[model samples]
Target: MAVLTERPAAPVRRRDRGARTLVNRFLGYAVLVFFALVFLYPFVIQLGNSLKTQEGAAANPLSPFPDPLTFAGFERIFAGTNFPLWLGNSLLVTVLVTLGRVFFDSLAGYALARLRFRGRAGLFAAVIAVMAVPGVVLLIPKFLVLNQLGIYNSYAGLIVPLIADAAGVFIMKQFFESIPVSVEEAARIDGASVFRTFWSVVLPMARPALITLTILSFQGSWNEFPHSLVSVQDPHLFTLPRGLADLVSGSLGKGTQYPLKLGAALLATIPVAVLFMIFQRYFVRGANEGADKG
Candidate 1:
């Protein structure tokens, strides 16, 4: 019999494989860092320009360093403009809208998820359809309704229209469906009414979804511009975004006024940024939970 000696197996290229992986990881990280800087460059410019003199900002709007830094822009923001009023309105509207959305969205979500009612499926479908509709499409109708209701140019118009949204209801409903029905059934077995079960048992367990909704609602109301544009024309009723727009549109009159405008815009961005940073972990969890349910 011919001596059959299996040729030695080719040496595994483990070293080359490891080196390739290392190179790939480095490139991936490099690309990510590059994009991060690109994305953040505008904000960096915004900050730098906000601290610059008007002449300095105008000369070098793209510069990320302020030469002869000053606070005159911030001073002008408060002393010369209605920044304080806009801030107060934003806070009030944000808080009320967040609270209303959390309550109303959760109620609607639970009803759709667990309730046995006529048109339940159809209502849920309609809610989904509403989410698909571009909000701009509703602007004319929204204005018409608000005008008819005689609430235009008032806080009610600003606050009420934003209190609850189809998106919030959809988010809450998806999250609710992920929860085990047995949990609510147990509450019911102990004689909890439908509303009581929702309030005491279900809502408490839906903390992630609630936080997500609160953050979204707060951000939406804080940055609300189109709604404010259509709802209120009074300068006194202007929210931060609307006021910022007015500030940029020759409200301050002549000259670039770059520092003052950027400072005001920067101040407007802080609340939402801080809120997101504080609740970022919960927000991510909520988003993941919603995604998994979907």
Candidate 2:
């Protein structure tokens, strides 16, 4: 009874602001869902049509549900093609290349980041320059160099050129620079040699960067076609990508076998997809750290 009147009802502005925010959030979600559908649409179609008969796939190219599913395409992929051999080769090359990239790139990156040497700045600048060059332009030069080295049509050609990537080196270098120098100094104080310090002390802290590099190396080497095309002419040495390309482009005689090709493509994509899913956290962390360091 002291005031006998309720404070004037709350101002309308607060409710108005909240309504605007709600409207904005709804529009944002609408846009995100629309784009998600657009991007996922093709993968859905591929997966669905891969299960369909050739006739069914051709008739319903855009459909995401097959009327009747068949495994004939998958059966043909293993039985009618050199998929197993390609898989083996892809596994070998990807493993070797990933190992080499992670080791050599990290070594070079650490050198550039921590080691004092003449022309260190120049060397890093050269790495940056190499990154700027288009890969297509280097193909011819790479071919000539490989031919001269007498390893052109061998695994050496396939693995060696790819083992050291400027981008990987840059990524490792950036990450190494972000680590506090005091950590390495402490290792040094504790009687650790440079290599031991790097291998034991610093490398453990670089798991995020290493995982990022591994994913990149695996994906790049797995999907590599142009390098394999030029590096090895032997059908026995073909990787999954090269084999898949040959399969799609008139290798399977006569009319378009969309089901078989799509099936093979789908299988080829699964490994990388699985790897990404497994290490997505490390990849995101590496990217964020890289951004902050930059």
Candidate 3:
């Protein structure tokens, strides 16, 4: 008699469980949608206002539609400013910095990950420790070193210091260690030099990690501002971020020129946007591999 009653209760319990799961899933989606809107709303407003006239933007600051669309702000950005020169300088610095970081960081990472040096463990620990130090604390020390090295206020000062990053070295080392050791040993047995093996055999296999490193280096160098502010005082050497900062800081005179400011900012973000869009697949793969390796 008890078994016959319990069978009926089993169906009721499953129905209740299914209802609870459905409610939880609905709540989860609602939370996700809410947060997405919170983050996306500002970008929508920025785009909308960039096309608006100055008077329209000022009067209806929160409005998402331009009262009367105008391209004068963009016109001024190209015609009335040093934005082109800044863009050129930014491109030059970003390219060099990205290349240097990819090469130097990968070499150091490979050495740390594979080479049997006397103090390899200690050196890697030191690299990890350096990453822990706040970037702000290094500004004064870095400035003093650049001054001493006679590279202050030059392109060399800006480019050289940013070439190698401890976090980047750490990322490369982690990914390199995750690779199969047998592959490297086969190259060694075939009489390949360590550099030759690393350059030819190992590097090609590290495409995901290399792509990850390249994007990071490009983004870091492209959006860099504080380093530029401290390293070079000359307007001619200013990168896009530095120039954008100058534009925002009362450079265009009184009143909020929202259209011009937003337009400039939008232009500054395009390269990074394009880069992420093109390489998003590799980035996702690298992230998954990193998680597995971790």
Give the TM-score (vs. native) of candidate 2.
Answer: 0.89
Q: Each prediction's TM-score against the native? A: 0.90, 0.89, 0.89
Candidates sorted on lDDT, descending: 3, 1, 2
Can you write out model 3's per-residue Cα lDDT over 226-280, one digit (the tens) per residue?
Answer: 8998899888999999998988884786567889889889999989989889998
Cα lDDT tens digits for candidate 2, 80-133: 999989999999999999999999999999999999999999999998888778
The lowest-lDDT stretch of 10 consecutive residues in candidate 1 is: 1-10
Off by over 4 Å in 1: 1-12, 253-255, 282-294
Candidate 2: where is the Cα deviation over 4 Å?
1-10, 253-255, 284-294
**Candidate 2: deviation at residue 207, Å?**
1.3
lDDT (CA) for every model shown? Answer: 0.88, 0.88, 0.89
RMSD of each: 4.8, 4.6, 3.9
Give the Cα-based TM-score of candidate 1 against the true structure.
0.90
Candidate 1 residue-wise lDDT, 1-294, digit = tens? 224433343235555667889999999999999999999888899999999998899888889898879999999999999999999888888899999999999999999988999999999999887877787877889899999999999999999999888888988998899989998999899998999999999999998888888887887788888899899988899899999999988577656788999899999999877987898886676567557545
